[model samples]
Target: MKIVITGAGGQLGKELLQLFKEEGYMVFPYTKQQLDITNRAKIKEMIEKIQPDYLINTAAFTQVDLCESDIDKAYLINGIGPYYLACEAKEKKVKFFHISTDYVFDGEKIEPYMEDDSPNPKTIYGKSKQLGEALVLDAYESSTIIRTSWLYGHEGKNFVNTIKKLARHSLEMRVVHDQYGCPTYTKDLGIALKDLLTKPHGIYHVTNSGSCSWFEFATEIVTFLKSQTVVIPVSTEEYGLKTPRPMYSVLSQKKLNSNGVSLRNWKEGLHEYLKKEDDENGH
Candidate 1:
């Protein structure tokens, strides 16, 4: 299958690109510099040239705090960009796959969020992403939307990398405890995406099974590395984020499970990541 992946420079996008290439599929990757999805003319031009069977858009203005101050840029890139891709992909008869986030919901629910849950975004970043999901579906009914949470990948800046770095230099680290979500590995999510290639096209919640607070995730990280750094749990107010975020955004993977694909636990994903890092570093 021929696939065109936008946001190739991103963590998840890079993983998807590598996975597809290894599977012997014809893949075209575009970094934000190469393809600005909001530019309708350019998006159309490039997509026409590729004529891909599927267009997977991972591009978004994901800086949560920055998005608060730059609402226009957030909506333009995260909301309108997917709309443009959907419009063009529809004309080409190519299936559109969009990566969404758990932030779409308010995180008020104590249980894991399902695909059909009503979205009440709490921040500009969440609103923009929620808008994108609606726009893509409205533009093309056949489009597939996958919502994930707490993503960390090898190719880009993520919680895993940041924590690993901090553990080495800092004597102690403080992480928020009230907020909870699944820590998804890009490699695992990439494999899940490959399985969804021929499945029904609609919104699906995909994440590594189980959930934890940022404090727990950080503690796990240090434990895996045998670091002496201390991990302290703090409340959201104590953490002092510039933007409002969900306190509990764990997503339900029931939809993905019903589709006959299941991701392993988040701990397993983290273990695999550390193993890969060890191998790469010749440890």
Candidate 2:
């Protein structure tokens, strides 16, 4: 099978690229520098030339706060990019898989969000992603959209890296305890994506099982590292982020489970990630 992965520089994209290659698939990884999805002419040119079986789009303007300031750039990349890919993929009859976020929905529901849940985004990033999801599906109903949350991986700057960086500088740190979501590991999500290829194409909520607040997640990271960094829990008001966020964006994996695919719990994924870091560092 031939696969084309955009946003190859990202955490999830890098993981998918490595996993696909290890499984012996003919995979072409393209970073933003190589293939800007917003460029429609370039997208068509590349897709026609490669004739890939699958095009996985992981490229996105994920900086939540920055999205508020850069609305046009965010919509251009996050909203319109997938539309271009879907149009080209549909014409070429290639399977298009788009990655999305839990932020698509407002934190109105206390229970976990299902795939069919109504999306009322609270931020520019969420709105743009929601737009992207719609554009992809409208262009090609056969396209697959996977909504994930709180992702961390070895290859990129994520919450894990941020906390570790802060830990190195300060003995104490404050994390918001009110916000809640599933923390997904890119390696595990990549495996889930591979499994998804066997199932029907549509929207699916895929993430590590279970959920926790940022404060709890930070504590777990520190505990795993055996670091003396003190984590202080604070409310969202105290954190005072300029951009509004979904307070409870935990997505249910019932769709994935019904498809006979489910990821491990968040804690197990985190443990493996830390272990991988240790191995890489020769610890």
User: Of the candidates shown, which would achieve the greatest lDDT relative to the real structure?
Assistant: 2
Q: Show the colliding residue pairs in model 1.
A: none
lDDT string for model 1 (1-283, tens) is: 8999999899999999999999999999999999999999998999789889999999999999999999999999999999999999999999899999999999999999999999999999999999999999999999999999999998578899999999889999999999999999999999999999899999999999999999999999999999999999999999898888899999999889999999999999999997897788898
Model 1 poorest 10 in a row by lDDT: 274-283
lDDT score at residue 140, model 2, on the 0-100 scale? 97
Clashes of each: 0, 0
The lDDT of each candidate is 0.94, 0.94
TM-score of each: 0.99, 0.99
Per-residue lDDT for 243 in model 1?
87
